[model samples]
Target chain A: MSVLVFIDHSAGQIKKSSLEALCYGAALAASTGTTAEGILLGTVSQDLSELGCYGIGKIHQVASDTLNNLDARVFSTVLAEAVRSTGANIIVFSNNLSGKAIAPRLSARLKAGLVSGAIDLPQVANGFTVRKTVFSGKAFANVSIHTEIKIITLNQNAFPLTAGQGTAQVIPLDIKAAAPDVKTVSATQSSGQVPLTEAEIVVSGGRGLKGPENWGMVEELARVLGAATACSRPVADAHWRPHNEHVGQTGIAIAPNLYIAIGISGAIQHLAGVNRSKVIVVINQDPEAPFFKAADYGIVGDAFVVVPKIIEAVKQLKGVA
Target chain B: MKILVCISKTPDTTAKIAFKDNNTKFVAEGVQWIINPYDEWYALVRAIELKEKDPATILHLVCVGLPDADPVIRKALALGGDEAIRVNADSQDSYYIAAQIAAVAREGNYDLIFTGKETIDYNGASIGGMVSELLDLPFISLATKFELAGSLATVTREIEGGEQTEQVGLPLVVSCQKGMAEQRIPNMKGIMGARSRPLKVVEPVTADTLTSVVSFELPPAKAGVKLVSADNPAELVRLLHEEAKVF
Candidate 1:
């Protein structure tokens, strides 16, 4: 029996979360004394074998044009068939949007015990048991799976990426493709300088930016840091930024490695979506901003003056100019 | 359209979380239970929206809980749902809950199933997807905006860096999040109508469960915040390096 990892991708490119899941799956397989393999759906130009550096032994590709876009039902059905065909006892996926949609379906199809938002590998001294976060990252629960097969969706940033020296065997799977009941006629992609979810660092502003015209400093700092830009709900609601850029309980949730918030009071609703960041630096002029309570680092200074200085410092530190 | 909305009772967001019985279970002494916030925002609001679009549409509310959960179910009915179903079995696991929901959906012949992106209580976000798999239907999650035209439904979801819009056929499952629809307060008429609506309580069909919760535990207490004077931003940086050691 093998461990199967689903590689999430879009528009012919793999997502960073996929790599994190790959490492997680590889580690789990090591503990269980089983080989870790991966399954890639759709067509991508990236070399699948190169990802073997993540410590997988084999990579299975089902390169079909129809599989380019995500269709949860179709992907789950195909993956279920792949599990049976490859004799995989464990399946792994990143706990992102696609993974969240597909993991449960795959579990029901395979009758495997499933865990979502898992923070660590199963404690496998006895029967397999995985620990996951509950209550929106507030608490922990240990769940033991009694089934013969198991599935887990690892939360992104929960596990650090580990690299090894090896190339995986890229074997193309020959399985009958299932037709998708859904069809995508058109997709409206968000046009932005940085993609929020994939960015290593994100510089977000809140009402503290004052108005849309005063956003220049925030943008300058974000550009210097090579980070994506975002806003709180009030900024979005005020139309200072698009609603899509809002990151809060009512907006997109993100967990970047470095999250810098400028001029925003962190409401609980705002905190709910972004509390998972690795390092949070809140740069608000308000020392009393509730976000300061959660920040790992805080700079109580005016964004207008402080952000520009930080940008200059970063550029000098990087020796860019 | 026949839409089924799933709701779960959860602790209020502000409730102080604690553990009892050697940290094996949550302490329930003084906490108040309400409809899961996300479930209320997505499932309840979206159901109301659909009902408004088509007055003939039927909206059913379902939950997996004991008889005491009837008040929560009635609250959902008052929120404009037409009928209610409470699976008599207490949900011991996510799989069992999904099975109960799938059973009801299949029996009711629901064309669409609406659930919150995830319950605030467990935050598993697994039931909607599991039920979709069981029923062999398409599942879309974290939908911000959705519109149904004829037999096709288009949904917009927020992905890592961008947004994706997908169009799928009928008989679909969608896990709703914020922005899918606006929140609504139930009218007095709707509240009165809810009191008279038929709430069918049924036992869940037996299904294989793969997992069980062994224990629950509170997270370790966070170290008290270390504050630096505003004049010394560099001191703040030093604290991150030395005191917190998290930078």
Candidate 2:
């Protein structure tokens, strides 16, 4: 029984969430008394050996540009072959967009029991049970996978990335790439911005901001704090912000280290997406806003006045001009 | 064109989540069930829009649940589905649900299969991929925009940093999310028409149940909020730095 972690990367750079998956997978392999390995499909510019710091003993690379763009069918077919050749009984993935697409297809192909949005390592002592978030983070469910081969997609930020001293052996695995059925027509990349899923801190605004014209303060505050900017459902619905920047039940769910809400009243739908944040701070003029109940710290003030002040304070504290 | 749209019944977003039966089963009492917003607002609505563009298009809805899921299916019918199918089984395992839908898809031989990105309850986001694999068809997930021309379908899906538009052949499975279509309310005529729509109930196909839930637990409650006066914005910053230590 061995563990294999899928190393997800975008444009040759490894995602931060994959580093956490490596840590989780390596620890799980250690607890099970087996070797942990990584499988990288597509080309990566970074030195593969550097990833050993996350605890994997070896990495299997399938270096081909054809494997770059995510085609779930082709990726799953290759992964199923990798699982067979490596004799791996368990697989781990960071539950991001790519993982969400490929993991289940792989699970169906391999007839392996799969669990997504897992918050922690499996309880190996008792039949390989995994705890995952359910009800949009409102509740948790401990799901037991009965199949011999188990698949788990770890939630983003659920596991901390711990670096250690070691170098992983980078072995090139020879596998024929399947012809992708999906054809890529055009691709637009959102560059130079902190991706919301990986952001440690997020500054989000809502309808209370009044209009899209007032969004400069939110962006200024996020810039000073080095945080990503997010918006509520209505903000996105009204086209005040892009749908990708929307964080709510129907949008991207995040669990940042610190989530600051400005001019946003916490609807249950909005709260469901962000309740998992380690710390929540709400700034709204209405003290009766539902968001205060879920916030760690709150200030009943107009966002127009309050956000700029907080931005100045953050700048002063950080010694930024 | 025949399109099969998959939907699931979930507790209303505002419903208070609580588990009963030793935390193994969700309490069903006093809970209002709605068609998962993603399925209703995006997947089904997009299919309905396609049907509207071409009156020859046949739109069907498939769901996997017990009788209680019927009302949710009816709501989708009211929204614009021409027909519905409910597999006579209830299971939390996504693979099982996908298998049932795949069976229905296989029987119907749909030109396109649609499902939401993920249900609001489990947020597994696995069904579309699994069903595509089961049917041996191409699958695109989290599609924000979809347009079909002849046998070729153009779909734009959300990727890690941005978006990617892909073209694929028909008999495809695509999971819908925001930006695919606008949400529509059912009028009196649509509601009355939904009652006469045929909803076929079939026994579930044999599929392995690979996972089982052992227990459920709510998230730990917050200790309570600490309020700082608006005049003391700097104090709030200090508390965030020293007390929270988030940075």
Highest DockQ scorer: 2
Residues A35-148, candidate 1: write the lDDT tens digits: 999999887889999999999999998888888878888898889889988899989999888998889888888888898888889999989889987766667899898999
Q: Model 2, stretches more than 4 Å misplaced?
A: none
Q: Write the per-residue lDDT of candidate 2 for residues A153-266, one digit (tens) a residue.
A: 999999988998999999999999989999899988777778899999999999999999999999898888889999999999999999989998988899999999998999
CAPRI level of candidate 2: high
Per TM-score, the best of the predicted structures is 2
Query: Fnat of the models, one by one?
Result: 0.61, 0.79
Give interface RMSD, every candidate, in order. 2.5, 1.0
Error of 2 at B201 (Å): 0.8
Clashes of each: 1, 0
Check candidate 2 and list the clashing pairs.
none
Query: What are the runs in model 1 whose C-alpha is more than 4 Å off?
Result: A237-239, B226-247
Worst-scoring 10-residue span by lDDT in model 1 chain B: B221-230
